[model samples]
Target chain A: MTGINTPSARHRRRTGRLDWIWFVPFFGFTLLFLVIPTIGLIIGSLTGGHPRVTLKYLAQLSQPQFLDAYRTSIALSAATALGAGLVGILLAWAAIGGGLPKALRPLLMTFSGVASNFAGIPLAFAFTASLGPVGMITVLLQQATGYNLYHHGFSLFNFWGLAITYLYFQIPLMVLLITPALETLGRWSEAAASLGASRWQYWTRVALPILRIPLAGALLVLFGNSFGAYATAYALTSGMINLIPILIGQEMTGNVLFSPGLGDALAVGMVVVMSVVFGLYLLMNRKGGRWAQ
Target chain B: MRPARGSSWLVVLLGAAYFILPLVATLQFSLQTGTRPLFSAYSSILTASGFWASLGLSLFMALAAVAIGLLLIIPAAYWAYLRAPKVRTWVEFLSILPFVVPPIVLVFGMVGLYGNGFGPLSSPMVLILAAYGVISMPYLFRSIDNGLRSVDLRTLTQAALSLGAGWPVILLRIVLPNLRTAILGGAFLVFALIMGEYAISSMLGFNTFGVYMLLTGQTRAHAAAALALISFALVWVFVGFMHAVNRGNITFGPGAR
Candidate 1:
């Protein structure tokens, strides 16, 4: 499997003209379920009570309410991505840099795998149980220090609370991403140290420069992950938060205030945002892949 | 040149506290059902009318998706490994394209392409099951490819061919047994995902476990907490099993290549 990519006739067999037939199931499945639906969504978003394509609903996206949703969604995603990305790098660095006990690395990694997969409604419940009104930590903090979090404007339904909830999975995802990237930087640090570079200097000149691309790439992924997430924010706030996914949900499920194509337009906008973010991620990864190797 | 133990321990401790405290708090919250029988929420949830139905549906969907995904992916991956490398790249990219189109958007597209409620396919379950197969492709392909990397498929196939063994024999008898770990690993990952999935299920008006959890969470806090713990337990069990079976070598979710 490793060396199969080489074009050597001796290494790879290009025989079996009918070999492509096996992939038809996959092609048909993707086309029917994934590709066709996305195309339908884009066309639906463009349709404006005419045979010709129009951007009337797309123009509706500039309305203050819709604009607010996009802003909140993007801000939440960016904040959580940067917040989790920083802390994840810290944890991954600690575990992989040989500063922790040997057993701790695998434990950390296994936990990372678990936590990253741990998202959606259950996560919202967990955070609410921890920090919601009358939650354990809320009650405990008020009892121990008499500091009412809610009185201090720390409601879990607000933007910051949602950010914290998002960080739970986002951080683990960042750890999973940056750990292997961290593993590749040990040699560079050692070389810098051998040149009598101080720890700070080694980090500043050698480690950070090489890591910048992968770090940015990882952050981009974290951003995209948070952006598309609907369940966590929806479950946590229940419409208190005006994020894009929840808004899209309302538009789709709306019976009374149903705008003609607003939901489809919003959905299309989300896909466009995600595409641009991932496109940059691919570019960063291509350049960063060279350094990591 | 030594790693900084003090800072490392500091970061690890802070991180551990942040991660573990929520679970602890969630457990405490689940148990704080005042003036009620001990764990009545859990008991009542078990006896709840829609609980089993929703959970059972999600479970069935997960199993079906895993089976269908394996059937489609194993052959495609094997064929690509033997014959075409370029096609493998295209298929793999398409697998992860679900990432860009969030579940809400995908369902929106489906509604637009098909009818709103019930349309061409007769049942929304069929479309959803197929979508699950497509969405599970990224992890499925990677994991099966990971297994394919470990064994010499070319040599095994050649040896089997020399013995007059057929393709079915080679795939089912030899390849299947050898790739059990990878297959189970990917299956568990998909199982964990589909069981907890909320977006696609809710958008389609399906009464999945995730949708059920949301409804319960809104009405009954105690029961919701109990259900939340159960959901977490389910995920932990499935993911832990995958990790243990793969000996912690398998990674869940896509991360670089």
Candidate 2:
């Protein structure tokens, strides 16, 4: 009787000693740096002041100014994601089927690694000098063709300008993420063709369906990547452009006085948008895994 | 398997042009000062006031971040790999959370929470390093997890335990040596991220290399280009080092000498 225990208790005794010791540092760091601050933001955004709850900040999200910012941010990210996703698939396809020099693949991969991470201020500077009003390309084009790039409506500070600048990093990032998926396509395509499928039929019925999940997943990632970006857009436009991150920066960094609670609301809104995007990403990946197998 | 090579070359050439044009333009811009040598802009950065300081501060911060990130990740990864494999998904989700939660948002929260409670958290150095450590968690965790996956962690631990080896001896002597490549890979990523990180540091008012470059871009365009090229070179070196280490991993498989 002393040695015997109920089955449930014995089962619990065998598996219930949670190995939480190794989690101490991770949980501590996350709680301090990630969780607690986020929680604070949530609380801050919810309450107008101490000991009183208010929806003022959340309600501010409906105002026209905030709406415009959201619109521009979403539009920019969607455009960039679609563009980068399509171009990246092309680049990856070429790397596989383009019959470039053998050394080209590694070289392209290395460059993509650098370019993908090569964002923020320096990237903005490169684009400004390369495409700005008095930039080298502008000056050269003016001298050769006698056409002002700006007069022709190609300013690097406007919406198109930002989109182009975003592509610098976006395309390369897409290439890196999609290359592995593309590499597996050749085998799958061969399998489909061996089964007597025509080229167009193979792509439409078989290849495209298989790639649909990963393609959508990559596009969502690109959207999230651009949506969360701050430094590049901020540097290029100096917060003049109405984007979510820029709007958040302006709200928090007011020259005279700042609104911490309002800023938290904005940050929370950003998290919500990103969460939706990532949720779709997760769903696509899950559905795509079955076909991938 | 090689598809027709026609359109692929067109696409590759177009990409190469788009990628290389700005670099060429930047190089030419950096060399535009008539009196000095073509490398004068680079030389100027070497002699420029506070350039070294900013670069030094960034390096120190990056090093600290890598150390902190490794300290936090290695133990958790090792334990989870050996004991509670079910927790790996949760850990992975947490690790990648930073991507969805942008640095700007996190720093905003930091300002509110710490700026109110802890005065020292407002210090530029402390806040930026903490942010970097958190931001680098995903890469560090993935690499180390991949490394641990390559090795049979449970079997290694059991064998070491059966040999009367202590936990410290097993981890430090046996595990650490086997994980050299992964650690290096993660460290390179951390270094690159820190070197180019601008949003948090700029918002937090830290004088890192990125901050310095941003400030320079405001006034001296050529100098900014020079710094940009220099930053590009540094990133290239890190990528090259990573590639070399990965190539060396040919011998890292099981039973390899």
Candidate 3:
């Protein structure tokens, strides 16, 4: 590829001037629609109904309810991320370690891609329909063994239920993100195994070390993904779940403590948490890229 | 290798079953015929007015959004590839911000921005803009970026210029043709997202398919199941079509008979 370019040609090329006219519409759209609105949200969090600009809204976030919501959000997000990472790593291992038929790889990849995006309300509905009072599984169990899942308080509208629904997407996403890492390891580990290393030794000394950064990075991305999720939780419990995203939505929609300022503060808090997680993901991605080289 | 193969098959079957179980249940619910709840939901949804309207609206919005997104993204991606490679990362990041930020937060921010006289609120246009700008980002950017990376942009430009072709000709005749599949994939993904998107549209008060589903769930359980099944089928069909296209490309090697 480098041979196609000459030194003289490379030197003579100037930094191409951007056609501003071409970008004007897109820039205007993004700036006005996305950037400005976000700025408004930030500012809205600081000021009250009179726009006096006070820290009262941010301070209000310290209340027990808000604090509990934050804690729940963090805990659920962390658990989901960890679950996704472990399942993803194992699935990737199964796929790339010559565990599956080569013909099925593409099929699994496509299935995973679709499933990963298949979350939110539909997923919640599916789970509810399958496990709720009239759910198929609940009905089946009741008929066969005289034991009703819902009659015994087996509702798919609580924290554990939300986490399970989350895994529906989280696991698939992790699989997609980690598969390439596993594939890359396979290429090198095959050679190491050929050099007389046992399977355990090969994984311990070769594959695991190489995959550490990417695996962690993928987990961080999952953490951020689940942390920011709201639609699923909202659909399941209608903002009664008390997750941070649900709390933010409730505040914005005038549910409890319907202060736009407080809502903005919660939004800012969410942004801060996700931004940090995403930053770590970026850092890990950079390191992973370097390691791949 | 042999034992691993057995376990892999087991895992694949289990995974596929897990993914399909909810869909199958929903389908069964949709196809029931009794009032006692065998498949009454499906029949009611099929007979409902809101179901069809919401489905039509979702398809319309998704198509419009995809068209608008392609129009903007193709040029923007091409321009970035040719001129400002250094800022490509920033542009990409900006495009994907909607994905990273929770949909609730994005909707909140959007409502604050456009819910007033400043922009179109409670209108399809705002939803279109959101769809075009936010959901289409990852798909379009990845497609265009991958397409750009696969080709020799400089050589193509130079060849086109040497033959007295303008930038427009090169972009239309050369670059776009090469990036057709990528563009199609991106467009389809955007379509799927828009079709299935519930949070933003529902929050904004537009009765798209997803919103309709939520509403149906509230009012008529059986009808909602039917609607959900219909949506699942539509999305499944689209995903399957894309996969077929991708598989066909793989077999034909991008330029085969």
Candidate 3 global TM-score? 0.89
Tens digits of lDDT, candidate 2, B94-115: 7777766778888878877786
Backbone clashes in model 2, listed as residue pairs: none
Q: Compared with the true structure, what per-residue lDDT tens digits does model 3 show for residues A72-102?
A: 9998889988987887666766776645668
Query: What fraction of native interface contacts does model 1 preserve?
Result: 0.66
What is the per-residue lDDT of model 3 for residues B41-155, given as tens digits with 9 covering 90 to 100?
Answer: 6656767788789888888888877776677667777766766676566667776565555667777877765676763553546644664466566566776677677776767
RMSD of each: 3.9, 5.2, 5.1
Model 2 residue B179 lDDT? 87
Interface Cα RMSD per model, in Å? 4.1, 7.7, 7.2
Task: Give each model a TM-score.
Answer: 0.92, 0.92, 0.89
lDDT of 2 by residue, A1-293 (tens): 66346443353355457568678888789788988888888888888446788888888878897888889999999999899898888987898768888899888888877777777888888888789888788899999999998998788987889998888888988887777777778888889878888888888887788788888888988898889888888888876898878877766576324355677888888888988998898899899888666
User: Where in model 2 is the C-alpha error above 4 Å?
Assistant: A1-18, A256-258, A291-293, B1-3, B119-122, B247-257
Q: For candidate 1, lDDT tens digit of each residue in A157-238?
A: 8899999998988998898888877887888877887889998898789888988998998898899888988888888888
Ranking by DockQ: 1, 2, 3
* Chain A TM-score of candidate 2 vs. true chain A: 0.90
* Candidate 3, pairs of clashing residues: B32-B39, B41-B222
